[model samples]
Target: MRIAILDVDYRSNVARAACVTAPSWATELPLATHVSDIESVQEYEPGAFYKRELPCLLRVLEQLAAKPDVIVIDGYVWLDGACRPGLGAHLYQALGNATPVVGVAKTAFHGAETCPAVVQVRRGTSARPLFVTAVGVDLAEAAGWVRGMAGLHRIPSLLAAVDQLSRSTFETPPGASAANAVAG
Candidate 1:
């Protein structure tokens, strides 16, 4: 099965999508293609941090034109907006059952329990912990894969590469400073 691991870039309109492969028996999440796009995610209220993320979500979903059987999304769907169940659920509705969708988040939900297959853990350089709430794809599969292919480094391999790629896409540094870009 062809799998794409997705992650969002806070600095730009692009989201990262890469092919996930197991290079060794124990490791998975080897990423490639690592494309980025400008999408519309304004569905969330302006005050919401993810309001601007709508564009990336749309652009990321459009990549599904290739019709990979499974799409592993970057954030766990929760709250009212952005890419959580609202967007993920909406997207799944648009794609129908023909395509299976899964959400993974760095932050967990306090008000709700969880669906089957989602996992939680800390990611990124700061290692600042957040709950990962995913709905579309099976995280049991993703975590086992993530255990190997990446470092505790600030950015996930796929997301890090995608962040770099999106900056290059516009020929810009992503922000006033590279540091700002990554931090954003």
Candidate 2:
């Protein structure tokens, strides 16, 4: 399956979104990579973090040549068992709920342990667990895919690549078209 791992980073007024695609969960290297820069991103809100992030993610996703079978994000899908929508959930809705989203958060949300939507996964002997949440896929299956991802550390390789890509310096100048900024 073609799985896309996505991440975003902000610098000054610009937000950079990066996507890394792999054929399988255990692949160490990406089959392709894409980056898009969004200017004047919205300010981060306390409980509405998705407002600042979802647009950037959607813009970057547009750069993909084909829709991914599944998407992995760097945050929660549901904030709690009540199914309070987070970034991933908002993304699922925005896509018409056609794509499955798996959220692998580095830190736990408050009361995440008891949340039915959340699954805590320990990897690579690290005491700190990855807080996993999902929509449109089995939580246990998502956790297994994450646990099987190619990496020696707690964070999977593709996730690390996307993170680094989002934060990396873009060669295209500010105000340049997204076409100039995207790289595969």
Instruction: Give TM-scores for every candidate, taking all chains together and pairing residue i with residue i.
Output: 0.53, 0.95
lDDT (tens digit, per residue) of candidate 1 on 163-184: 4444444333333221112211
Q: What is the C-alpha lDDT of each candidate?
A: 0.45, 0.90
> Candidate 2, clashing residue pairs?
none
Worst 10 residues of 2 by lDDT: 175-184
CA shift at 57, candidate 2, in angstroms? 0.6
